[model samples]
Target chain A: MATKTKPNGKSEKNQPQSTRLWLMFPPKLITRPIVWELGQKFPLVTNVRQASVTDEIGLVSLELSGSRGDIKAAIKWMEKLGIKVEPVEINVIES
Target chain B: MDKQTGFMKALKCRECGREYPLAATHVCEFDFGPLEVAYDYDRIKASMTRSAIQSRSKNMWRYRELLPVAGEPTVGCEVGFTPLIKADRLAKRLGIRELWIKNDAVNYPTLSFKDRVVSVALSRAKELGFTTVACASTGNLANSVAANAASAGLKAYVFIPSDLELGKVLNSLVYGANVVGIKGHYDEVNRLCAEIAGKYNWAFVNVNMRPYYAEGSKSMGFEIIEQLGWKIPQHTIVPMASGSLLTKIHKSYQEMTKLGLVSDAEYSVHGAQPAGCSPISVAQKAGLDFFKPVKPNTIAKSLAIGTPADGFYALKVMKETGGAADDVTDDEIRDGIKLLAECEGIFTETAGGVTVGVAKKLIASGKIPANDSAVLCITGNGLKTLDALVGHVGHTREIRPSLREFEALIEAETKSPTAA
Candidate 1:
């Protein structure tokens, strides 16, 4: 649906219900299965678009599909765990 | 673009909080701020060491941990690792204790430092799944892209200002690229390429893939430090075109120290530009953070970036390092080319002349410490810009194949054999 609920507590123009975020995990969090946690913890559809991981850190480009409120909550939850969560302007690759 | 540089975090906006997936996109969708590749330096440091780097190939790709690419490099993989010559003659002329030349004039493939960026750009484009690559350049970049893309088997479309030298034009076309000669300066051509990049699926290296392309210049810095016995030079001078190389070299120094590969020795980074289009130099001398763009009208067409994209960052690095910027005239540029050639036997192009000429001024003016070792970056080969030497260099004498005439000419010049 085009209409979406306000998560920032401000009324805004309707944004897409499905979106993506670029998640950066610090060295301390690299060993955790965050992708599994993302799906188990949130009601949103979690798609791991890209992941580059090493012993020091992990970065994931993730796409989520769900209601506006659920997508916002998913990102908020990730940020609470010391993960940097920011929206991703995607590439046309794999399209 | 590839799967290997997994240390690269998401593309973050330079001005805003916007972030982007590591893609071909450059500008932030929200505020139009440029997107730069973010890396987990901690991860890179964990994966890198002086011995680890020394064990790898001798080319630029050996610093794969720091470059933005994720997977194996697939373009111009053998480029970089040019010689760093110690210039005792040039240093003595400028009254300096020591001087070194980072001679990218002999860079692999296209004989310029542009080969370094082109190698990374084309490799990133392939990693991003771009079937075609394009760029707007003056001469060196066009030649580099064409050559690297041809070797990589990717379609290339290189656009350059129509008035480039004949040698550069021929060099690009010989690489089997589709060369488009636009009727404008490099800045205008670059502006047009920025528009074209958004419309087409093709990658415009300096336009859309700039963050990755710019990272390649850091290898020059890496090589300089590594070749200097894993030590940072007290002072280094780099030529400024779009200002990316200077900024990247400074970043390389900082990153090296951060990684514990080099000591945290204090070093200064100087910038060189031609007087005709010396925006960064002008800004530096005036103590201004920003620079006014100028129309490029110098023989050093390669360093004639009027509206430099990385000028702000370049100026910041200069200020932070306590280094200064200076410019040289077209006449001085020619003299510099000849000076290096006659003294060191290295025939550098106009851009190299700009660098050496500015170094001379900086040393003579006591801007750079006369007692410390200085490294000047010579960026291109003189053969590529031969037109710059048409009236500048001269043939001293003409002799016929007659023994009598040869003896008479030798006597006229040298007075007598013993006095000769």
Candidate 2:
């Protein structure tokens, strides 16, 4: 799902960026379509690079390309749903 | 680069294949893949012969060229070469034909395999002109870094979870190293260490110096091959925490085959973990390549890494080598510790218990056939984790210091139902 473009207004937080993350869904939320929800709720491109889902848990390696503010909000929303979100490999330390 | 860097060529990213200088750095910049020390295998093959390794001192340094060090090692020089025992009794008990225990429970400087990695990391840190070294440990690594750094005259700061065993905490405190206990788990401590490592120049062994520190585990694999008469075992079982040791052991086997140290043979490298925190094994059991993180809750504190750093690599190694992964309950872990102690006279830590327990399960389930020979890596000494076995082992029979009383106790024992 794509949002309508605002042609004139742009802020620093809305600057386009791409990021990767690892999302771990607990057993309770395993059946929920969280990735689909993440896409529908946020104006971002979500691509699942890899995923492993069992009855007990769901692990997804997702790549998101969108505005920085939108990505942050999506992550916060996932966290609020009791999903554990981590950077792909904690690259900030090495960077 | 005036000093000798042994036979190491450069640090190469495992994923992106980018090369970095041979320094205290870990991950690649682009893909965030872990950087590993790439070696000059041709030179290593020319010099690292069986006879050459046999002639060196009986320690982990015998495989010094393959280890990531510059010139001679200055720290933990006498770390490894722990015994590889032929565990016939244990084999019989587990219904396996042949079994061996690569017992690092009695490893030098500290009674754990962490000494091997600490030796390499601290020596490399010294070579890189660092005056202080540090690590984020569960328990064993802190004790090893504390003891090794003290011996090397380098200041050490070890961070651990506040709820570590008393023996491990005291082991570090006695070495005069600065031990910091975090209020959270090991992953938190490690995350904080990464942030601290970015700000300070101190060599955090598992963070900045991981590429070197991880190679130290290869020495254990090398020693096993040599101790087994220059032959690789058909099956080997290793415990998992961050899962680095299992992957490094597999790498060692491959390296030896490349260098013609051992004939290329088919072998499997299995992984074991506590059931409470077995993310990798759970994924492996489900035939999945990725693992979901779990909050650890087990008596096997040393193996309680919820988010194993090398979990992906460990899974890959197991899949490639036709190996399997399994975990055991806390009760099964205690039973494993007792089985090893009673049968083979080796008192290992909870990590070893996990290995033994999983081996038993694999053997019973025929994943590891009863007819094949296997080796179980016992990584730490039992004395370090006494809290796990306080009331589990059998109690001592108390009798007064009198022959009459002892005779009466013996007579009572003979009449007991268990004796019949």
Candidate 3:
């Protein structure tokens, strides 16, 4: 008899997933120059909807929709060039 | 059914637990509680982990399992993963054992935590096919929404109180948003935004797109846990405005625990506010089930919400978490601002001052145990509201070129001991 493997909480390291791209910026990128850099990247980027600054750590959260390949490439390229890029998480409270 | 990219599920109401189709509707029909975006938790829990998150990128989106937007991002592409500094010097001054500061004042674009929420809201807005986005903000939110909207090529409309600080107005206008100076206070502007949400299909991020908007705040809490070796703090101190961020942070901690990314631990959540406008704090102080709105006459403009929509729920959370609320004076707020910068090198805005001031007060009152670790949320940068300290802060000494003259002045100043 074969025992079933329980899926522990672990990030799927080997899976190549295709999903829309979204990025959150560090506080330092909020100045005029970084905005220009972002424009150059996701040109299909319709708008930078929100910009919020906290006391010490600055974060510029951006929302853009593009192909999985282009978005993933853009994220990788930005990270390579020292730009902070991460996947946007979706949260739901079962209230 | 190509699997929607930037979104996960439907919108859920905060009060009645009613669900709505994914769109820009932020309020519910029954009792009018705010609606927020829901997600597929099983999918998120199955995929996200500490190593996966670390390997991805530095921004908040790295925890894509926790955010609402589906597919690839198109704007506000650079945000989140802000510094969670260990406040060693501040701990020494306050006589606390371990203290951390979530420094969001330096957040990119407009410099406040609002960017996190707005980024998600606006991103979802575009995905829902919205060309125009709007909001009712006091200062920081206005600056962020205007700038982000401009960059994303969306027509932006910003409605703010007429008497808002000139710096805030200028920051929003610089982004080329259609800035509307309303005659009433922020609450009036917010009410107007709600009205417009009922009449228009255009996305009002905070009003209609709030479900997605609030998800952004979770990044702050997520970063705190991740930076702390994937462990949640013993206590968290946050300033309450609309009370959304505080509630969201709690949700983040719970989610992490549920996903087994972090262990279950007892945590105390504390809230701070200016004495001039502190409904939540006052309710917490009086041990009441509800909050009584005030006229809001505080220097901490960011925390000056008289009637916070989430006030009651925030009170409930504080009670549930064994947390407490504290208030500080305007002078204390100013002193708190200077103290954090001087001790911790974190230049915080007035809202941050309230949090810091209350943190100090809580420490002195033996409320926050000296042994337990604590994290204080500093919400905005001080530079945006310098007018609050025009005549209060900085040194004004007349110096002469000659050494002899300077020595004489120094001696005189030292002897008198009354020089500002």
lDDT of 1 by residue, B50-105 (tens): 88999999899888878888887889888999999999998888889999999998
Poorest lDDT segment (10 consecutive residues) of candidate 3 chain A? A86-95
For residues B1-420, write the lDDT of model 3, one tens digit per residue.
Answer: 125743377788776788988876665554345687777777777688778888987887888778887666666778777889999999988889999999998787768888888888888888889999887777788788888899899999887777766777788899899988778634334444554554678787766677788788998999999999999999999999867788899989988999889999999889998999898998898897666556689898888776566777789999999999999999999999999999988888899999999999998888898877899998888887787887778677777688998888889978887874
DockQ sort, best first: 2, 1, 3
The CAPRI class of candidate 1 is incorrect
Best by DockQ: 2
By lDDT, is 1 or 2 better?
Answer: 2
The CAPRI-style docking tier of model 3 reads: incorrect
* Per-residue lDDT value at B157 in model 3: 86
TM per candidate, chain B: 0.95, 0.97, 0.95
Tens digits of per-residue lDDT, candidate 2, B122-160, equal 999999999999877667888899999999999998776
Q: Which clashing pairs does model 2 show?
A: none
Stretches of model 2 off by over 4 angstroms after superposition = A1-78, A86-95, B1-4, B184-188, B417-420
- Fnat per model, in the order shown: 0.00, 0.03, 0.00
Model 3: lDDT of residue B386: 86
